[model samples]
Target: MKLKFDGFILALLFFIVLAYFFPQLHRWENGEVLAWITSIGVSLIFFFYGLKLSFKQIKEGLSNWRLHVFVQLATFLLFPLLVLPFYPLISSEIQHDFWLSFFFLAALPSTVSSSVVMVSIARGNVPAAIFNASISGLIGVVITPLWMQLFVDFGQIEVLGDVYWGLVKEILIPVILGLLIQPLLGKWAARYGKPLSLFDRSIILLIVYGSFAESFDSGVFETVGVKYMVMVLVVVIILFVVIYALIYLLSKSVFKFNRADTITALFCGSKKSLTHGSVFGKFLFVNSSSAGLYFLPLMLFHAFQILVVTIIAQRYNKSFEEAEK
Candidate 1:
């Protein structure tokens, strides 16, 4: 019997420790140099995504309008709405920080790599997962700030607009170029799935390192008490359960998707991207005093989602085994 550990989770922990102990590696006003590198890496990851996915797969995934729409709605609309009612909990300054983090978690995009990998592990519709996860980030680029604007004033139209333009140049351009060249390089990219996965996870690892380094250097966790931490953890776990249950029910009863696609919708719809959360936090709270706390909920949710999704994926995998037997 063998146990599978999530290397990314371990790496995130390592990065947190590295940030706390040696902040110099990833500490900068915006983690400026690494941010540029991460941007380029993100673009390359999408480029490879384009290269590997056949145009037919892309077209089919996009045209699955029902699945795509349902998943996106759950991600952008449903998740935030679920968290909104708890706004009253932010009465105190401490609680206000938690709320900001929670709302940020709610507004983040679906994580691309883990969502797709978990969908694959659960033997779900991989193409659909890829499409939903990829598009989720693009949607978040627009929707996340809008959600934040409703709750708190960003106070700078120029900064907000700059984030959008950055996404267009850095993320959208690479994906489009990759799609354009997919016919030429798709087979080659497909052949190297393992390496491409490493590339993807590495980008995430760097982002985690950078985000936490910024947080730690600023002493973001100094005011956070054990009680506050525990409460936030509980809230995050409950949030995951509610979202997962809702997505599962909708997939079966409402959407009537098959087993594979149900898994895709369940996983993708429930995930919140730490990558985009980190990026948004850097810009949204760049000069704010509590900038560090902004990503705390997102960090917590990232860990919680990985644990729950892995368990669910394993259960699904076991069921498949029994069916085969």
Candidate 2:
């Protein structure tokens, strides 16, 4: 197995184990310090990485209107459109908060780092992936809130009104600053990108642990039983399959992109960004128990997307090797 997958699985297992055994450690009051540290620290790291991106790259990416449109459609439009109709079918016994959270996950944008990595792995359009991924993050700041307003009642959450500004200041501004500094740090960024990405990924794992630890501490897990867990797992699987299949068909028929580009679209387009999901969840839900529940689908989707797309990417890699032979 790839080291990325291994690292993710290990991090997940560690969090689950921590939540199970160290109940006190997971408590919000007890863990608040760690949580804040992880949140602020990760946000800063995210900003620095963003600073390394160039405005010229963003402009060039925008110029690839076809790829941008297709990725956006698959992420913001198609996924949510598929998910909304099913909300009625889900049993009312399930927490409204959890349902809303799931919907939020569906509405978020494609991931930045992983999507680009997957695109590169599958030998797809790297520049296009960078463009689409960054643009998707920017668009999500606007689109996610609008979707929430239309579908969910935000009155319960105090942070809803200022969430976008928080994202802009915490996430977007940092990213923009990073891009601006790209001219000076471009070489340094290129040299250290891998290490920086690893650092970013580690911070994300901590965020996941902190979020879940908070949920466990708040008795959220006790409220959700085996049935709820099973339902969530099923929903996650269905979401992945439907999105993957839809993107595959669209890539073939409409986009007429090459095989590698199609794979990139399928992976990047079908998956949501965990980094954005975690940060936004923190901003939107704040100390609410539902924030953890809301981020559940995103966590599940991240693992599932990587596993599924890794297999697909490997297969694509093999096929390319065979074609050359």
Candidate 3:
């Protein structure tokens, strides 16, 4: 099986390097323009997300209660549990921020497009993948912040109030507006899914650039250093492997899920959303100049998940094709 290179991953890397060299652009006029641009882009991204969701699809996929429950639990609960143990062990503010980054990764939703696409490639339960992946984002809008609230403080402004309010304005309202108008535009949105997805990626790239630019401007990386980044990558890989294995064993052995459901659960359960990471990081770490530091682990995890899962999905597809032949 041939492994395909993801241009998106390369684009993410490119943006980070660009941010390093041209960090000034994001901070032009104290970053007001860049911040305004990303904020609008973030809302539109979720608006398009809402537009693409199908109630019929969600209803159809809900029948498989076991698979749905397993995926959600693994996403919101199991992933966070793995990282929670390390919270108390943090020795300094810097160490705490690094831990928060991984925890943020754990708390994110499963990415919708890639999870569904990978599952489809592997001959998994595609409808269920779509349902789980779609609903995961909506759930994360509420759950992710609550998870973060357990550890994060928003400084002077009331923590829960400001966080939830920002979420309402940035994510929930746009999504609801999209859902409300879906009857008129849902078909249009579906017809143009590719462009919408491209738009999503473009906004994500902008956010990454703005974030890293902030980090570079503040010299946050100087304190965090390359050693910690290497550590973050190692931890991200270990986290993915462990979550993937647990989902595999539980779905196949404990639950006796069929091949398709097992594949869907494995892929969807092990994934995290970089899109949400970028948007939510803007709000979650708003008080910290080191916000980009928090996004670093998530970006690493995002790239790693895509590369590893695509390889596994291709192997699954090849095996299925051989069996058919």
Candidate 4:
């Protein structure tokens, strides 16, 4: 018999279960310490990311106006609008939590690494993919919160006033610091990639555990159950397919984008970053007890999109190879 552990997702579930049954384990008065630790972890993750980024590549990608415009609009505008109409359909608090999860997925920016990887695999515009994927994270910092504020009241959030400073302290400043010091440390950071990855994933898991622990302690997860989980999974899968198809058609049939640009547009536009989702959640849901619920759709979308997109990119790659042969 063979058993496989899917690492982060499994770890996420374990921590969630642990927190649920043994909430005391994480409810230490040191909750503030954990928050600060998680904050520092987030900053470090973005910092190292900044270290590895290349501005020269981003500059070259700016020339493609059509590609940039469509990808950005798809990410920021089109994605969220896809879920807005469903507002009427959600009635219960559990239902609303799921809706917020869906909205959270849409509101997020394109992921950096996976977006670029898939585009490269599909023989896409790699430079533009890199550009859009990189910029999307930065842009989401401002746009996602503003979008959330459209529905949720700001007065209720205590950490929001610290929002800008928190963003700077936790995200932008560290990213900038890493960028500035990249010439010196980028190589070292890149060299020990495995450990860095282990470090990154560990912090993310901590954040997940901490967030969900809080939710569990406060009795937030009790309202939602396995049926809602199934609903979310289905919704996430549908969201990925619909968005991917819409972008593909618009890129090829309407915009007349060439093969490479189409691949870039498709991959970059269709995906959401869970990294940014977790980091952004810390700030956005600080005063709200439903913070963990907001992460559910992100976790769902992240897993589903990777599974679906990998198959699609592989098929796309195969087509190009067969044509050449």
If scored against the real structure, what TM-score would every candidate get?
Answer: 0.87, 0.89, 0.96, 0.92
Q: Give the per-residue lDDT of model 1 (tens digit) for 1-325.
A: 2346767777877877887788776655556788778878877877786676566866768867899999999999999999899887667887777787788888888998789999998899988998898888878878987788777656664544675676666666777888889888887887888899888878877766676677667676887878877887798899999999999999999889999989999999999987677666655665455655666667778888888788889889999989989
Encode model 4's per-residue lDDT on 1-325: one tens digit a residue: 1223347667777877776776564567657777877888899998998887766767798899889999999999999999989999988877777788788778988998889888998888898998899889888888888788766655755445766567767888887888889888988988977787777788887777778888877788778788978887788888888998999899988899999999899889999987888888877777567878888889878877777778778888889999999
- Cα RMSD, each candidate: 2.7, 2.6, 1.5, 2.7
Q: What TM-score does prediction 3 earn?
A: 0.96
Candidate maximizing lDDT: 3
lDDT by residue (1-325, candidate 2, tens digit) is 3534447656766876675566564465766876677767666776776766787777777766777789899999998888788677666644576678778888899988778877887788888888888888888988887787775555656444577777777777777777777788777878888788777777776666667767776777788888877788788998899888999999999888887678768877998988778776766666666556777777777788888888877777777788899
Number of the candidate with higher TM-score, 1 or 3:
3
Once fitted onto the true fold, the runs of candidate 4 whose alpha carbons sit more than 4 angstroms away are 1-6, 156-160
CA deviation > 4 Å runs, candidate 3: none
Q: Which 10 residues in a row give candidate 1 its minimum summed lDDT?
A: 152-161
> Ten consecutive residues with minimal summed lDDT in candidate 4?
1-10
Question: Candidate 2: where is the Cα deviation over 4 Å?
Answer: 1-4, 23-32, 90-95, 156-161
Query: What pairs collide in candidate 1?
Result: none
Error of 1 at 63 (Å): 4.2
Which stretch of 10 consecutive residues in model 3 shows the poorest summed lDDT?
154-163
Candidate scoring better on lDDT of 1 and 4: 4
Cand. 1 Cα-lDDT: 0.80
